[model samples]
Target chain A: MAASAGPEIERLISLLAKLPGLGPRSARRAALTLLKKREQLLNPLAVAIAEARDRVRTCSVCGSLDTSDPCAICSDNTRDQSLICVVEEVGSIWAMERASAFRGRYHVLGGLLSALDGIGPERLRVEDLLRRAGNGEVREVILALPATVDGQTTAHYLAERLGPSGVSVTMLARGVPVGGDLDWLDDGTIAQALRARRPA
Target chain B: MAASAGPEIERLISLLAKLPGLGPRSARRAALTLLKKREQLLNPLAVAIAEARDRVRTCSVCGSLDTSDPCAICSDNTRDQSLICVVEEVGSIWAMERASAFRGRYHVLGGLLSALDGIGPERLRVEDLLRRAGNGEVREVILALPATVDGQTTAHYLAERLGPSGVSVTMLARGVPVGGDLDWLDDGTIAQALRARRPA
Candidate 1:
């Protein structure tokens, strides 16, 4: 980011530096690449970003991000409306979708209940979830939140709230991963795997 | 890369994966982060990129990139025009400027001549350097190209070309880099450092 390269490029570099994994040096390199391949990369990327900005929407029903109001998953009739997978954040939903194991819709909690961070049940989408659960369409709600203490506490709170609505609440199994080696597995994970063991 | 993220977000992730250090996974992460921080990062970055694209201009005299025709360094009157540092690419000019050691202007050759890549003298800005060197105002031309074989070959070719123009030709000194460890230094660099030793 030298004065010789000019202010506009410098501004672009500084802005790119704020991305998740990029720092100043890598941002400068990326800026140079973008500048060098203007027609091939810069213009198209700018258009893509603008288009995403103009079209991005949050699903009112499931609290997921998409270009539509209800989101693709919520609007799609092929997905099981009777089953809902609850997550701690939007990123977790994407991760779950990547696994391709669940055919159900999703509800994003936005965040876990952290008393130290002042994130209470009210801070999450708990009321909306409860309302959806009581609508008589959902038969089961899967708590696919993190395995952390806060995640478990939020899941328990959500279970208690949704139990009265006649919907069965379940959680992700805590155990060793599919390809996990016992030597590599942590103490708590090994213990959970043993405790949750059942007939295959 | 899940389908639930929509086509627009997927396109953004793929395009971002083409950047210098970003891969497909990191690109998705970057896109999600951008989506979350729409106003703070996404919108401003898009604007900066568009501005940079609309304003960037290659320096007419020295071949560096800037918003102005002659570039900031070339247009500045205080810097020594008689001494010119010739580098292989625009990135090198920024690298030199960051050191704050040189008080002269720079000339970007655009690329080094690579036989395997079919890059010849005509592909580079050699004629521009020759013209600038023979302009009577310039007294010295420094070839600050890389230490690789191709870079040295290009330097030799430039020296031969600039010889008839009456400007004295010099090159960057070959020695150990500052703060570089001796154990990690290559044999050639150690040999060069020993040969270029100076009295204390």
Candidate 2:
């Protein structure tokens, strides 16, 4: 068991440890850093977290987290509302936004269909997506999920469900990434690249 | 510039990015995770940080941070008052405490002597430590600083300063770690292990 650095600091460390990349040791270091720079980091972080807790809300239509009912992307008139990109989680939406190539709205599935983890379509926002697809406003549903087993399963299921509704379903193409060397490309990626070869 | 995920979420991400282990990308992920688990994580973390900020104080005697003035270790009567462990920062004190081997009080130096970094003895708690050593109650002062160049320089300076004051100053021995493999050991560690060899 980890020794407590008093109750308050210990609680802070434990919470920090629950973050995506941090563990117990790094959390303790982060806590000490916060304590050392109390006014600069700890106070500001506390205020930010409290503000986020009070203000953040999920988009009722798309399930993306934001300060408003509909997220910035969903509410923006400039974005292509006809194209909806489906992602595994809100983090994936953020990743897509970082690329700045997709100027379309998003649908967050909460998680991929993982049978081993007991996560089904019912546990995700699948019904909401199907409902959105049937509304006729959306012309294309881009499946931007991870190329994993569960992700592919969810994508295939979504394609099957949305096919009868007449909305065109597409997936991100898998190949050797841009700026990647052919020598370092995996066999699977090389095979994918060969299969999806385009006209010169 | 990084794109903002609303004002509150962006602020939280920026503040979290300043933590020891998390960078901007990981901070964004953490912010999203907090938003997703608002009731479970974000609110409690905010409360914990606020409580730590309001209640935590540095020990006047040892410079260790806690809810009390003398801190838990310093105020505990069961600990050996005659022995004091000197460390570079408060984080080092926490690391020492986690080992649960040292039952003595600690003195935080705030930082090591780094001429390149413009950190001198005046900037540290050197005078406080010297004064404590001169008070006659402390029989041994253990230097538990890092094995860096600055750490050794500070240790040498402290030994010189405390030598005239009659309290024996000792440094943590350098040798192979308890479970370390000789094949992966650095040359300096191997040399130290050879020099500090013991009969079985």
Candidate 3:
């Protein structure tokens, strides 16, 4: 590979190919682009990745990664501290934030409970979430996890654990999502939509 | 974005987003995977990229990027130095190597002459290729460029310029590519294939 593609470039391409969504061909293209835009993009990107790798740490409070111990959201006192949204991963919090609808704190579960994968409640930050819920400041614990079996199982497990606490437990609304057509939606989603139908 | 996604992680995602074939969503995914496998991937990738950026240099003889002044191919003594394959970019050399058929030296033109893009022969390594071709050791110079107007124009220009060098000028055979359907192939390709039909 080095003889053909040059050792330095080939090494860069191999490492880049390990990135999610980048196959060997796309990695080659990305490597070429990086090489072409060295000063403007590649240098900055390399520095950024190194900085992130070294400085980024899990928020002690919310389990989200950030430059600081407690993430920006966890540190922000302006948001509703009484509402805590439980999520499967940090990405879920970002997605919810992108909607700009949820103004509350978040608890990253790290992962969902999966029997096949042997990921139990202990694997997740379930204890941390329970401790946060029982702290008296949080009024609600919304399970904004996926509708999948693993997600629901984890949500149920958390709800059961938090039952002793006085905090309100809720699940994200389930139905056909925005931009979803009735015919195109899955059977389960359609059924849920039908069950949760509201006046137009 | 930093407020929602965490500053350091968000910065990493934004930088990754600028990579070729990666949008915001895929960048987020890549960032997540990197954060998840920090020791295994993120740290090493950052190091690899920085090393490549710093150590990689253009081969003065053939214009290919490598750790050495004259790239591996250019320095190789066993390869057919009498023949030179003119290519548009460094990627073409790698692609040719993948085919394992071309055992000649390579002359990277850097880019093709494009009037629309305001790129002329002087902008490319046309003079460099001419010099290499006229060095008296090269017996033939093969134009393995694209079939586009700009590519063909550049090839014709090179062939005409190399005419005085007394070296044989040839082109890569144009035809229906292997596994390419005749029905899916364009009109120009079909005509070219018919004009250059083989005995088989």
Q: Name the top TM-score candidate.
A: 2
User: Please, what are the lDDT tens digits per residue for candidate 2 over residues B1-200?
Assistant: 35746677778888999998999989988988888887788889988988998999999999999999989988999999999999998888878888888998999999999999999889999999999988989999999999989999999999999998899899998998899999999998899889999997
| lDDT, candidate 2, A129-176, per-residue tens | 989988879999999999888989989999998898898999999988
Q: What is the lDDT of residue A177 in candidate 1?
A: 91
Q: Tens-digit lDDT track for model 1 on A1-200?
A: 45545678878888888887888888888998998898899899989998988998789998988988989899999999999999987878878988999999999988899988999888889999998888888999999989989989998899888878988999999998988999998999999999999999
In model 1, what are the clashing residue pairs, if there are any?
A: none
Candidate 1 chain B, run of 10 with poorest lDDT: B1-10
Query: All candidates' lDDT scores?
Result: 0.89, 0.89, 0.89
Best by DockQ: 2
- The CAPRI class of candidate 3 is medium
TM-score of each model, paired residue for residue:
0.91, 0.97, 0.94
Relative to the real complex, the DockQ score for model 2 comes to: 0.75
The best-first sequence of candidates by TM-score reads: 2, 3, 1
Where does candidate 3 chain A have its weakest 10-residue lDDT segment?
A1-10
**Superior by DockQ: candidate 2 or candidate 3:** 2
RMSD, candidate 2, Å? 1.3
Candidate 1: segments with Cα more than 4 A from true spot: A1-4, A175-191, A194-200, B183-188
Interface RMSD for candidate number 2?
1.4
> After TM-score superposition, what is the CA distance of residue B176 in candidate 2 from its true location, in Å?
1.2
Q: What is the Cα root-mean-square deviation between model 1 and the actual structure?
A: 2.5
TM-score of chain B of each: 0.95, 0.97, 0.94
